[model samples]
Target: MKKIALIFSLAVLLVLGLSTAALAATNGPHGGFTTNTASCAQCHKTHTAQSSHLILFALVSGSQNDIYRTCTYCHSSTGSSHYDEVDGEIKDGSNLWATSAGGFQSMPTVEGATSYTTMATVSSKHNADQANNTLVAIPGGSSALKFELRCDSCHDPHGTQNARQLVPTVTVWNTLGTAYNTVSTIPNGAISMTVNNPTTNETITYNDDHINDFCGACHTDYLQTAVNSGSTQSGTYTSGLYRHRVGMAAAGASGYNAAYFALPTSSPAGDVLCVTCHYAHGTTAAVSSTTYANGSTLLRMDERGVCQDCHRKTFSTSQPAVVAASSYQVSATDKNHVVLAFNSYMEKVSAQTAGNYTVTGTGVTGVSSAQLQPNGVLGKTVLLTLNGSLTTGSSYTITVNTTTVKDLNGLAVSSTGNTFTFSSK
Candidate 1:
């Protein structure tokens, strides 16, 4: 019996040992001692340390930007890694040369004059260069959190549980409080990028849904709560706040194309995060379109192509139709107030004219006024006020005149689909 017990104890020990090994962290290259201790010498030195933090500067011969050179040794266009962030290309021994977060800046020539201008159109970048990046107050953070930007400021060389080895902690300003007094950790899995080389025929996927949480770590004021489709305005200001809502569902068959805006897991559709429109690294994309001519802000597409891709307002030649699902929210304070939501962006002047609408229902009177929501001039919803109050729990019908209410593309609202019914609050 004693011999049998010893054999069982040995089996249990083996299982525990295997479990511990499986849970070990495998931080890539810079530090994952459990996987390989040899990686330490690649960046650190014991006796021949060249720089502070024992960083081995022997890899590159540049002293001006030694710290930046170390990271770029494996991450730049001339480096050995699959991701060429310096050139914003994925060079997996293939000809695809797909652009991602556009490169940091122009690549340095072989002569080391730093005048390579392959992506010169990408006028702006994160500026991770150690020599050039200056000490500045964080965009959405407090004065107390002033920091000189660097590659290590955002990335953790030692590794982390989050994707891309993002730094775990940052000091952010609390807008609700009087002082810069919030220390926060980026939520796990808020931003993740998966890319495979074409030589291996791998797919590149980026599902950075809560990326605002990561960017908001420093740009605190830019983060916003999600709003609904009908209430989402394009450009309007009220009480010092812009009405361009982020973190909202970019859903609906009529408003957005499912193919161009497909997300990994958006239930019925995808939500719009910060990275949805902007590239994380940087972009060399040109922006010379007539509608939205602007400087490079690391956008995925040129000019306002990112906006038009999902909004699809300019692309629509189809007649506008009322979306019954979102149009039914009536004002509780004023029973006469009713909101109408359309699938396409409507022209402000025509949609807000009272002469273009007629209201008929139980205990209803003449239409008093029609007004588009102050949210946007090119928004999808319009508010209507009746001359009299609607009966509680009573149904009402409204009609939009054909050829009067038009979309931004000058297509009239469909007369056949003009009539809609809503219950009074």
Candidate 2:
């Protein structure tokens, strides 16, 4: 009887031990280390250690702006094992580069320069003392007061149940779903935390879809789905169709090429969340087949690789129907029929310089007129009207070359297979 009683007691203790471990693992992502008060303190100290931040006073390869060099110290500069670069090779991990697609600045923010308010790149001379990035206002601030663009702006070092440790209020998108944006419920509840000694598993459970809202907290203007018109071709902003599609639904829907594209596991219900497309810190240097810089975009692959993952088609336009005939002989129907089915992505049309289009044909006579769709946005296709008609059972060839037409990164349209034939009837 005594032996049986002792065995039962030991079994109960074992079960309790296992239960405690399971609970701890559920709360703490870093090897069961509770992400409570000290979550951020682990990285920073009250004394503000200079070693924590990398200061550049004429160092090695190239100069970095004050923003990138500072925060990347932990994850980038020191060759730390946690470095975010692809091959662990550093090429400056700042998010601001040439393409400020959804940036708040009227002009681009540059590095290697002291001030970002005016210049587009970073100035090496501008230290923390010279200019405060927070002095200038971001898109969405609760107080309407200006703040610096720092890591604290988006994250809470102390750690929270929120994904990526983002502040709570930030979970709500500032844009309020103005036009075509995702509308999802935000969670507001206290969660548990756990801590275990000597562990490296720091994963957070992101249950809700608030990444877009988090990005929108500062880039409010990015939520706008409106086209921009300007005088200079480069000056115009017209990617309204699907530029930085934040709140837009991504649940395998029509707006996106759902036929081929699949949503990431992170994106719930198929919303193209911010984190879905961009990395929190910058990415390692990488180039795409189209000769565009995909590293900066932080796309899953690189450059336009994000879009090309599902949309794999060549650039070609075809005439559905040749103009039959007309009294003036200049067939408006034929001209409209010669539409270019842009299998490839297009940059804004205004960027399309004049005298860049070259249309020629053998069977078709008098190629009267041609024009791009949407006037200047990154339209999916170009409408070309022809002045000639196709005869019964007659085959003809027409070629198109918008040599100046390019993707967002300025890679010109493929100059091959611009030809099309009318095969029957």
Candidate 3:
């Protein structure tokens, strides 16, 4: 009777094991220990163990790192998967496949190539190799821990709840502190993906929380709390510049027009995220262009094309006009100083022409100079300095003549609302 009871308990345990495997992610190509327990043998050896982490691949000389060698063995162009992470190309049955996460630059031909070919150097990217690459500490973070970065540093092959199997907690071996530090992203929201193959459409949705804070796991002080609120620089970074807000709703943001956007957002309300503009793996975007430099900051688009996704200042079909309600404010300290705000991005050469503006009022002199604020690149505010101060309690009229001021697209400012009046302090 006791032997029969033991057999019954064993059967129950077997059923529970199968149920757990059914719930795991179907990452079969990566040796996902799911329904088929035999998949574990693909990456692990019980008796004849090799390198650290029980990895089956024997350590080769001149390899970047242990885990990288293990992953690229099946992820590179010559590997079984043909998802060459080195060159950021994927092979879908002899055809190149494209994914949201773009590819990297440097790639090797064999398991242990003597020298690597430098195709192109991406301006910005996460360090995946510690042996042959320079170690860059986490930005916005002040941790004094020195460590080696690997591919598995941010990804978990066993499968996870986060999108793309991103591990919730990252463990780094600190060589300086002689210990291990684990950065966590618990209590934050989840980022998920939905692929509709038949329709050839894919949508990524951010839930209640965002990925900005998830990336904040290592980027300690880059947390953005509210929409339109600027992120404060803490830790080591001391740059006091106003920055764009992330991890917040993008639909109702001041400069963002949802109708013009081609990116996905959170359900019900879309929130801007870190990955919304950047590629996690790497990018080959250009760093210099006619309008701007420093463009290749691991962005998904070339130059500032990502900025045009929502700003749309250069894409307006209507004539450029002054924003009356938010413009024409007299400075409290100096009555001669005033500000005028425009609705569209203006042409620097046209907007900064002092002769294009006229000031007429009591005790007011002619305009001295007109300068675009924020150094004029994509700036909409014009700061005007007057020749003489305006008397307090006096009304003044500022006129922007027709065909004088033009938008970035060379559209002249509208003639109807070209005149504005303001009362001096």
Candidate 4:
């Protein structure tokens, strides 16, 4: 009788194992573990007739649309019972998320009709959907394949180490700031985002090394230690000005100086990346006040304000600082203007030299910084007082010779012909 009871128990164990397998197969792919369980079939089916991509659950993808439907299944307000499915309006909302993991719950969506693609006037945006034109040539890549920017250019469907499942690596966008090398957009990775449960406030953290490697993959120029000595700089570098540096090495947790960057490089848990400055999905164009999105690049903060975060006036080394504060606003906040804005905030200028700041206009005192709107970090216009000349409504050109001004390493900021023009009142 005891032997029979043992045999009955063994039979029950076998049945239980099969039931577990069945349950795994029944669960959807979004939450199921693929390696040891059922499979992606939980989300996609081979014969159920979904999109060209084979995404299932009646989610269809035609020639024109991208993967929005399948992805939003669990990411949208109507789609999932999970957190509020809405764009976080730049991380201000509760329970936000990005296509990248470690992101806030606020994510852009198609059904929600909220993506940079919908911006009528914005020029620089990642067109994640358009099927035909799915690739961009990443600047520093060795071969054509590595340079290809696909539909999911900045994302991964499977999952990754970085937030929102952003691509783990990218080719360096090594531009030399010359006519020969113009820069462009970047790529995403395979797939899958790591998200925290808002109900419990569970969180995940990332390291700066990974952040550096990921962002450095594309934005290679700033991180490059050396500049091109010859007319061209490709696989070669000599000595270049140190950029407001980013990357794992410069991450705050990595013993990098906080006077430069705050803790939590990019994420609240800590570690920084490109997203810390420029919004990955793009923001309203602060590129320029006049023709925004028209031509100016969209930036998270006005170009100069991005600098003010740490360097209230000066950084670690001594050099004529990149102007203490802004006297200018709503103008072009693009790279060329910002980089050359060495004196953008020189409120008062005295003609110490005869031909420099006073070549045509007189040097006066009391001009600092002023702009129309302060926009959080924005300051005022760079004021230059006229001293030697007296004229009303007459225009004059002032040229500042940057070669005379040097950096910490004693490098000239600009060679010649850096000018600003304003009419006399």
Candidate 5:
């Protein structure tokens, strides 16, 4: 019995030793550690001890903080030691290159340059943010904002190559219904092109998406753009209209809108490009409380303010004014009014019997006075039916008001006027 116990103890000890060895191997150099790949060492260094943080990269000359250099090393196009050129232009163009066709005064350029005639502004272009690494709050103070432009944020460098270096595939909703859950695979539309490095003859395919997909990924206002361009394209907008002018004209009978093609369809409008509204880098928000305190990082102002940069009138003043509802109550058993289908034989009461009168107001339009039917000689009665799910014991007010309300046709109430009142039954 003693000999058997000794053998069991040795077996347990061996098992624990093997477990520890496996755990270390999973995390240690020979097992999983890899260079030319993403790892903690890719961005940080431990043994050098030159800087307090011991970052792998050197410090930027003019920046006050250490993190600035880490980002500028890869982002700054002019000073970097590693670079390639395509045709006469730099392969990965300088960070200062203009991103827009119609340039703005505030966009950044190579160190001492005055303006970037090529970059687009946020109001007109779709590009990544490269300005600063200051955290801001999302609207409604829901969550802290992301400040840095990391490789993983927009691209998955380790995953399979894709347009824009996207990690996986893109999918979008297809229809609307109560359950309204359907999606369709977005086809791969991006490709890479080989550019001949005149000196070395090395070939590099710069991965990029079709012009429309490149811009649409970030700029979600595609439908609005289509409407402005007078394109009769159909999309997922509430009005079933495509709002942008970038993508292919939606084909099939279901996607076409006759009103959008008032002009000849053959003469297509100008294509919408990615740089139409944004700068690749170097625009900053003002320090004002109204603009910056609630705005996004690298954004000049709040979304509403950015929208106003192009759509000045839509947000400037309230048009298509709406009347505020002063009071309302819901009751399952309370009396309410109703309108019956049109019938010519029904005696339409006039002002002589004002007591048993029909009431109308601007509160709800599309309900014509002619549709109202009198209950008796005095009290205008309306049959109210409660849906089964409505609360049984609740109380409600049935209001009736008389005022000259116009319809969609712009017709006013006849001189007979209208009535308004509310009752709790």
Candidate 6:
């Protein structure tokens, strides 16, 4: 009888062990994770086949239309919806989820409509025929390029904890500047996860939270350090002046003083975050076709599109000249036109002897003859130009103990005066 009882207990133990192993195997690698879908099903019942694939509790039905059906599930024009909570504007009864319905209908669907393909309009900026053009293979025949935009291209239905359900570790803004107070969009450097296949005994790594890395996968230029890395900056990339701060922090982050956005030293967060300009889903702001409105070179709204959100003055299309001048060093303070030319003949007329000119201004009481070629302009301006009998490639020097010259504004020279040696180029 005792032996029979021991055998029964052993059988029970074996059955339980096998059951636990089977359960573990069923879970595979990404086990013990409850997805957001469970939470989404609270208000929605999956009675039909189509509803089973959707988050029924979504704010609206998914079978409505291409634009409305999918978006309205979580977003709404009124009530306590995600769209309303995010300060999204509602047009007519529906919010501008993807494109402006009214504006889209107003324009002719065919070629006779307006040429610009605004976000609010039905026109598409991309040339569909060109999308399938030949792919140029890289050196050594590694891979070919192709383009497509499916529903998954811009969204992750998994529901991210971050606003807009964004992928992890992305930077939306990089530096804080006169126009904005944020750093370049940089991804969080750390944070990782993994997936495993029980049957194959294989594991795959995933980084769900690194912001910049995720956005860089699509917006390639934002990932580039050198301009030539892609099409956005290519020939236009320049240090300190022309480049946009996409992935770097302002200059003062590490006590370095370069040309970068300024940030408060006390702010605990150090780098720019990516969600700054781009909505992980979409936006209703109208952009230009050639620049940001249609699409940027990197398929972004455009540099001006991003800039205009914070700087309205810089993106006015009607005033092209006004907008262009403000984007560069063409401001009133920039002295591009303040020039000075050395009149060698006038110097000779004023000089008592050749190779020397008289000094008549304040702090210019030198009794000796002036070095006409170089001494006529001694630190009088930030930059100087010499024009006269001084041939190109001629070397000269200016010596001044304490002399002051007037600028076009008639202001006395206030900067330190040092001997500058240079040959006309």
C-alpha TM-scores of all predictions = 0.54, 0.36, 0.57, 0.43, 0.30, 0.32
| Candidate closest to the true structure, highest TM-score | 3
Residue by residue across 121-195, what tens digits does model 1's lDDT show? Answer: 345566566453345565445455554555665676777555467665753223342233434576663466554
Q: By how many angstroms RMSD does model 1 differ from the true structure?
A: 22.0
Local distance difference test, per candidate? 0.56, 0.36, 0.58, 0.35, 0.29, 0.28
With a 3 Å backbone cut-off (N, CA, C), the pairs that clash in candidate 1 are: 101-282, 102-282, 140-220
Candidate 6: tens digits of C-alpha lDDT, residues 386-418: 222233344444432222332222222223422
TM-score: the better of candidates 2 and 5: 2
Clashes of each: 3, 34, 1, 49, 35, 31
Model 4, backbone clash pairs (residues 3+ apart or across chains), number: 49
Model 1 scores worst on lDDT over the 10 consecutive residues at 107-116
**Candidate 5: where is the Cα deviation over 4 Å?**
1-55, 61-68, 74-78, 81-133, 136-152, 155-211, 223-242, 249-272, 275-425
**Poorly placed runs, candidate 1 (over 4 Å):** 1-28, 59-66, 94-96, 106-121, 130-133, 171-183, 189-193, 196-208, 228-239, 252-254, 259-269, 288-294, 316-425
Per-residue lDDT for 164-198 in model 3, tens only? 66766776655553455675554543546443331
Off by over 4 Å in 6: 1-40, 43-47, 50-68, 78-80, 84-155, 161-164, 168-210, 226-245, 251-425
Please write out the lDDT profile of model 5 over residues 68-187, one tens digit for every residue. Answer: 444333323332211211001121221222221212123321111122332223332112223334332222211222233323333432333332344233321112211211121224
Candidate 6 lDDT for residue 173:
15
Q: Compared with the true structure, what per-residue lDDT tens digits does model 4 show for residues 318-416?
A: 334333221111122211011123532222221122234432534332222221111112212222333343244444555555655333223343444
> lDDT for model 4, on a 0 to 1 scale?
0.35
Report the number of the highest-lDDT candidate.
3
Query: 1 or 4: which has the higher TM-score?
Result: 1
Superposed model 4: Cα runs more than 4 Å off: 1-39, 58-65, 81-124, 139-154, 160-205, 219-244, 248-272, 289-298, 314-425
